[model samples]
Target: MPADSQPASREKPSPAAAPAAPGAGLSAVQRALRKLGLVRDIDFALYLPMRYEDETRVVRLSDVRDGEMAQIEVAVTSNEVVFRPRRQLIVTVDDGSDTCQLRFFNFYPSQQKQLAVGARVRVRGEVRGGFLGRTMMHPTVKAAGTELPEALTPVYSTIAGLAQPALRREVRSGLARARLDETLPAASDWQPAWDLRRSLNFLHYPAPDVAMATLEDHSHPAWQRIKAEELLAQQLSQMQARNERAAQRAPVLAREAGKESLAEQLLAVLPFALTGAQRRVGEEIGRDLAREVPMHRLLQGDVGSGKTVVAALAAALCIDAGHQCALMAPTEILASQHFGKLVDWLDPLLRSRGLRVAWLTGSQKKKERDEMSAAVESGEAALVIGTHAVISEKVRFKKLALAIIDEQHRFGVAQRLALRGKADAGLEPHLLMMSATPIPRTLAMSYYADLDVSTLDELPPGRTPVVTKLVADHRRDEVVERIQAQLQQGRQVYWVCPLIEESEAVDLRNATTTRDELADALGEAVGVGLLHSRMPTAEKQSVMAEFSAGRLHVLVSTTVIEVGVDVPNASLMVIEHAERFGLSQLHQLRGRVGRGAAASACVLLYSANEGGRVGEAARARLRAMAETSDGFEIARRDLEIRGPGEFLGARQSGAPLLRFADLATDTHLLDWARELAPRMLAEHPQLAQRHIDRWLGTRAEYLKA
Candidate 1:
């Protein structure tokens, strides 16, 4: 085989081969490999290391430094079992110039025999300062004359009972037996300098002289090549999905047939004007609705960017065309909020035009739900807004032409597909999925490339910039005083806690406790209400209604109120244990306030250690929330902190799992892949599928959504 070509094989194994079931005859190493989801030789070969341990050369004990990992060969001068504080094995080792102590809190009798006095051994671990000069606690030890690696050792993510040496041996065997063919076409203008085989070889067993920084940073040419290939495979998968969706037929929802259509009339009655971004996105949706093919579009906006209005306009287009429309929210609170807003904004105008609006949620009484169901089935409800209840099997639509899903990421692709299935026979409804979480541009290009995206980048006029403050839990009284001041001014406040009830496992504050504490602090002059997921739907709705009506001065709740419980008069937000929440969640919780023009403020009260310190990641999240109200920036930072897989949710399971690519730093590579993927697929169709197979394996089925 050529240097760039894969090793030759008699026949290629299928990428989608199922793994052997438990109880089947398999070696211990093979079972361990299966546990890591690597049943095939190819899978084992592709299971890259999490990091590398540079054990090619041993360091002198005299040259060891604190806070740095070192591998050294030394003679065990003394070995003893210490039981003063606890039973521990202490082995004092000395090289030619300096000495160190190896302390093991857990050890077997066999290890004791191996660490006999005057025995020569090799140990690798971080050198830390200890009372005995230098110490290496729980260091990996190997007897003298054992085979040592000549290159950087791969350290894989493993489960219990799976030793690193055993795993490495299996991976090495797999690599040796694996035969791969070139997935991408031969070198072209856009191709990287290295080939697939060379890149994998470099990644798995880098040369002894290779700098650790080069491998760790993932900036080496070989790593960059592999990253680009992975990104390109993802791009190709998304492009295929986009093309497949485009091939499907859909209902053509033309504009309302009149000088002033229902949409126009509704817009005319709006108290405020639409932002430029909203208008642009509305036009985009309007174009998609006018088309005969199914529309798969994502409307992403910052929290409170008027996505609801844009969706309402799209619903109007469908309704005006003699069809029903449905909007599904993730939670009952959000569904009720949408129902109320649509009723307030479009009720009079739509009612005058002889159309009706209805809502159905899980919490609705049987009679009420039946009435709504009948209204929907009989075509009496022109616009329906609800939670997942709208997509239940018992509920049917008369002429569902459009489905708008709010907080689309919160729902699975299957739910969206099920909603589309509700359309009339031989017609698929145009789908508009809305997300308040602003997806980073790189993710949108790779993960959501199949859907047409419209961004509502501008906030409406009179929207106040929320002043965010990160306060330690020690200053809880100060935050409570500020809330009292806001309440005294007739403005409501939202106090968000991470937990519904105190958990013995976690030390975070709970909504119930916080509510009672606030009530006690504020006294009878302030009305305090508690809301959480554990509360019944009726009670939750009642508390929310009272809060919205200003009957409650402080509404303490859990993340259940994170998304869509909007109250313009609620100008103060206090989130307890804010560090426990994600950046986007913090942003959304903060969005609850700043909806009004009364100088809104959001106080993030976080717990600190006795030293008044927080975790680095948690501190970064709080700082990001305070630095900017821009959801996109926060989302980008969140992605940097949490990564793409978590930010995009499980729907990304089908896309290629990036081994070397950092979405934040390798965005340029993603851009190149996005630009080249379609062209590469069009020009080299066979190679494109192979490339996708190589990266995604059987996971390609995930992109069908």
Candidate 2:
């Protein structure tokens, strides 16, 4: 229920509880808050404030100087209130002729007490205008004789269900309980020996005038120290986990039915020609399957570059080996779409061989899911297409030989490991991690070091080229007319709107409000629809159905449509604010329309001079999109701009974890880290004995993010 909706009586005791109160009875939460590096930076970061001001001074009206901004106590003189029907509420108070009138816009009646007849009170405000009838409108106020401070106050961020003021009080109390000096281990044994006890003391309470100066001395460095510790700890934990997984992975690939023979049989049934890249990737998988050990391979290809085809080959190999295989996707839409394509493409081939496939997902009826699970368990289902639901305990594989993970980056290591964990002992399925985003080799090696990587950099033949152009929003009329003309020609188009929605569940706006506007211009006759994450899963699938089925001439959407939806009928992609997307994302969006053979074109609408802080990277991305359809090149350029964190989704796992390492500049350092990581783990995997382990242990927990 989001917790915040509960009544106060039902509220859990906040971190501000009494134990955190200063005079020595500190609790663990208080200590953690004191040690917390920042004010709610994340679930991990400890961003405690460096210092604070005591907002506890009371001032007299006679002492309030003219033309100064300050908090002062004042007595209310007889009031002459003005109620402007056409304007706002105005109330005045006289502090001996240099009176100030408070101006409030749309004020309610309860606010009248601020200037209650003959009441003396304290107020804080900027003195606007001087002499007779000076003013302070809706400035922060309190009751009479309330103490206020002239020092800048410390504001903090609160976690959900936490209040700002209460949090501040609690933090202050938590600091008291930490007994910073006692909590800090003596620095006698550490390098760069820091007397953290002193640092903590200053953080909690400082000498009068130099409090700010005292904090500035060590606060920033402490923050850096804490962040480094967090990073190291995460690295160590993952390294240890990886070590355990290596030993834990059972032997499934040794069977005679592993992949080679199955791959051959699977390949024999393809109706269309395989691209050279696809063939090469197939050969690699076939070779891996021939090995006695389980195959841990990663297939990285750009959007629409046929990663699924490669995955299908692996699955087919397992099927031929007399075992079942499971394919997992991150989203239901992507899963369903991929599953539909697979069933349509491979069912005919499998039908002749007397085999069948099954599907499972979260939204499926329990009864149907159970039926599929039973079929899979009995070896009646050769291939299972589904989301994470496939890894559930209820669904067991009778002879699970291989696991193909699509959009592998979206799944965590724990999740990736869970799929194989579902298989029986010594029958661990060959693991295949597939990604639509192109990761540079340096980043890939560090992040996916545990697995073998195969890249498909080539596009299939007969694919239409996307002509890219940059145009200002001022040419909307012309762009709208072009869209109308294209719609009239019976061609489908995708109008991609950059992120205008924030809800992760429905974060992609596609073009909600904009779609309404376009609908008005395009008229109700043309089949136009909006597709975004916010719509019910069924609704989104329905929209994709109408568009792919030629019912909708134009489908406006967000990046949600960038992956795995193939409509050979879509001939145009108009990306609004193309400058808003990353290079890889832009390339993916561009790839959407060119799938059809109708000679597709991508119109990149951007703001060149409307001046909203557009950068050279955006222009570079747009130019590159116009220059070539090569995704790898775009990825390389994108890496240069935003780094591999976004593309590889490895920032959290140190995918591109380098301060001194750059995919572009320090390519060698990155390569070195990648090479060293696996080897290091292979040697002293537990790392429980080394100084490196010591440093890493402290840092790894925070890295779980």
Candidate 3:
């Protein structure tokens, strides 16, 4: 919530605040279900089960497998509670067939109240043969529900203001009213493999496997409908955007690509040759320009893949068109970096050839930002680079022709659209959006399908490969000795941790203590600096400045330094407890090194001392990190490992709201969803099918009427 907003419950709630939709009336605490976008009730018969709780059969003592985790409902026969050494307590109970134990090292009095004499309860625990015979440690007990439905019960994510039973009751009410009739048009002849639409049709709801099965993209008959709606929505949006862009003209850069192309001339003078991929994308932008229609494109490449060079070349083309161009970045540091790169790429030629460039940021003096703003308005500044500060109310462009946005995801659709206001609508600026985090196609089609995509798939020839290794924390001394050897050899290294200070409550590394420890042991001679998001902006900027300028040899930092830091000579990136970071982030940090002629290394230090009860995905990620530096490969594996919701930090990306789909395993389904969706929607535009209408109606927020 925004700081200015009042507490939701305290506000004079409007009638509109009462959910006027299918999920509107969930118990107050059940409101979190809306955030997950997973609860939509059908007629009284079908209910949206949040989770499929498998308690259909109880495990007996004689039949219980050793070390197997299972959920069992049993009648508590007796209480055999005893205290062990070191303030430990052993609470044991029997279900007539077998006995299980709950072990607590420091359990308080309140925890004991959860159990009652001869109470019937359900528990999930790991079974092991201990000195007390078969013992289930730390079992979760609850009063069993009456009238068992003889199937898995759904468990919804709990919200603060809502109670689970109240939500379940209310949803039962709504489901009674949410019966699917013929509101949706018939699904086309085509359908995906799965058909778990019981709730939508008011049929029998899904089983656990069936409920989970709905999570495959375009694999279920329901998805055929859902995916089509997503496709049409995107396709419609793109067509509209294309039509709008068609009315505008590409700025004829003051430099053209041919003999008249100043951009080409500048490129010709560059010390390095452009890669084939770079040249191809440049040509693609050029072609978009030659037409009267404005270009709206995205240029995505890995870190250090020469995306900045591509942007500069595009800027050069815009200049040749005899019009102004605006390049926007999300951060001041990134803006300054881009400005520096542009200056390095264009200045020498401009100094000899006679030209001008302008830089703008909030940090600039009031007079400087205003003066630059005016210069930009008068077309005196050929290229303008800045942060969100560029979007200030006072800033305006003179005949803005090309608008290039860096770190595009950080900005919203409204912000991106607002960039056009700097130019007249009749002559809207062409757009070139860039992203370092490579998004999967389903997400791309769902969110950014309106724009054409140009990817930099190939690396520049002769670029050094970044050797990656995953080291266990048990070998910490050896890794430190190696770091010392590398430091002695005059190479810079970056140490990335998830936190800045050691927290007693959380099991994670902090940069401050790590920096202190490293610098103390290495004796201040190695220049260790600590950086984290909690620091003041100016302080963080200064730390980054030091690290970038080579003043700080060992910078221990948080994920704030995960993206867009270019230090060609820095050869080592040591990620302490790499398992804590997302795969995309780890890959981005690795991209920082191996940019220069020097061979780089990315050392992933995980706490292997912690037994690997961790899932297969974490292990797979470690293996993948050790095996390859290909970001695309890592991204695909990442999607497979963490699932989309978890990979992008759900609250930040909203990728998880795609409740019934998996981006990792649905490549074929997604391709088909992308391909056949338009065809399906074209045939039944009204969404008349029962399943299709239910799916789309459930997700109305993602679509506009």
Candidate 4:
């Protein structure tokens, strides 16, 4: 590599210089580069190649093997257009050792003119056996220009109108203009083996002997250094955001005269004792509620781990303080379920003290909604439970102090912010976000870095482990018979289907069809009810109510019932086409059962193998479900399969984003960065800012959001 093809040397720029101006000239190439969100020279330098191709060692045509990529330097002996099976331009090239044919299905007149007879050309492509001993199809052709590159060539992600050669040239130009300054102190113990500039040089132009596996696996020292720096930048940004949020003013819901007694009373009336994990997490929330600074916390618990009871205790504290508390759910069914459960538990205790519980959902009648709104505004409703309807402008809290969001990932950041804004002027409400879908510890560190996290790791006593079994679709009759037997024993059943309406595109069972099939199979011997998202809210609620009350023997529905519908007597759950759902979703569906004293089992019905083969990914998911009932393990597998992007829901600005760090494999590096971030920020703030600018640039705002 030439020294001139290196970045210029200079001190690192300030925050304002992060977004550099685009280079002049080459308008077409620049336009395509802009599509990749690359504008400055630094941006291009950081735009790492997806893969590298070794083209430095040219080989003889006779030595080339089929399915192998090779670079050949030869002189064209003849050029002709052939039209037997298709019109193509065939150019015969010969080196001193042997000869080969270069075939192009789509050729232009300019290409033909360029590949005239007796012209020397260099080509690189995969070799395949053709009519002529060995052929290189659609090989990249160029006039034998200056000597071939002596190092591995980078194959970058490109856009239309930007050929590989063009991209290579522009990237080389960007590299020549890039100037990197050390973002960390020279005395730091966490420094990389190579300097920033040297690392970039080696990454872009590795030696001819460099192993492809090193670069591809990202295990090379250079790549590891880059990953460490990226993780450190993310950690620093999150720490800064946390500090900012902590500085904000919030309402403090200190206990009134008898708030502690009220909490004790509520707990006393519960059917069972609180588990140790629940008590610990509840105390964490309690401490946060007592603070004047807003509480931004995430309460994570596995299904049936009693997160609702913890949240109810938090609400009791707020209610006892004479301030209104609102609990928001992602869906109407979930909201209704929470409302009913809370009323059952706290209505008796709260109603006697002139404190009422209100329910607001999209399905409520206009008059009912108005009444609820008025009660909330007058502060007569000490506790309010609703879906997104609670965040609407029409609803207001007279003395809102705490906002609790359930299934936190299901709601958008904006919606959560909107609910927080509902509090009184100059007072920020405390936020308690709950998620039943437990995230892996490594992921939670980055995903929920801004919030204090407390995990309810223990399930309440009397909760039996769910026995999961994978049943092929061919065993449908047997599974239906088992369900019938359970129903005849007076135990309720839940049959979950992936889809509500039939989809031609997807060859999976639908809820409606499954309901009809079950009805026919049982034939009045069991009471079967149908439930789906498309049905009227009232009708669905009625069916759910009947099922919970044990009037309905079996309820068949879609994934809408996956979350909040709970019945202790519901001992059996049948999931159709379980392979279509993700691991966390499967776990949530299975969580619906095993909530009661009786032993329970979950049946995962999957499509029969195609030609005696099932997809490896789907097989792993089913095997994991059958192997363990640990929600955290399921979450770890989910992260490994779907990655952090989908697992965290949709991408949003200011969210934590990693370009080089793999949460599955680079967790050790993440841990190192997490440990070092605070100290680095405290002692060397400028260097920390530079690191952030180098890795995230304008996108650092995503994590802050």
Highest lDDT model number: 1
Candidate with the larger lDDT of 1 and 2:
1
Give the residue spans of candidate 4 off by over 4 A.
1-35, 39-41, 75-105, 115-119, 130-133, 159-179, 258-260, 500-509, 650-654
Estimate, for each residue in 97-177, the C-alpha lDDT of model 3 and write its tens digit. 777776666566666665555677777677788787877767655566534455455555556765666655655555545
Ten-residue segment with the worst summed lDDT in candidate 1? Answer: 8-17
What does candidate 2 score on TM?
Answer: 0.65
- lDDT of candidates 1 onward, in order: 0.84, 0.65, 0.65, 0.83
1-705 per-residue lDDT for model 4 (tens digits): 333223323233322223345553445655677777666667777778898887777788778788899888899999999997999999988988778888999999999987899888888999888776778899988778657777888889988978988777777777677667676655555667777677788888898898778998999988988888878888888887787777888878777663356688898898888999988988888889888888988888899998899989999888877788999999889998899889998888888989899999998999999999999999989899999999999998899999999998887767877898899998889999899988798887876677788999999888998999999989899998999789778899998888624472242335667777888988877789988777799998899989988888989887889898789999999998888888899999999999989899999999857686668888889999999999999999988888887888742434646778898788888888888888877767766776776666766665544
RMSD of 4: 4.7
> Residues 1-705, candidate 2, lDDT per residue (tens digit)?
322222212112234343545576755444454343322212111234534544455444456565655666667765545655545666666555356677777566666766677777667776766555468767665676544444445555545455556566665654444322211112212222243344333434444355465345443444333333333333345555455444544434433633345456556766667899999998898777766566777798977788988888877766766677889988787888878878876777676767778898877877988899888888788899999898887888887778888877678656766787777776556778788777766555444444568999888777777788777777878888888888877788888887743444443433677788788899889877898766787788888888888988888887788777888888888889888888877887887877866877888888765565567888788787888777777777777778656666632453324332234544433433343444444543333223232233234432222
Candidate 1 steric clashes: 0
Rank by lDDT, highest first: 1, 4, 3, 2
Error of 4 at 691 (Å): 2.3
RMSD of each: 3.6, 9.6, 7.9, 4.7
TM values, all candidates: 0.90, 0.65, 0.74, 0.89
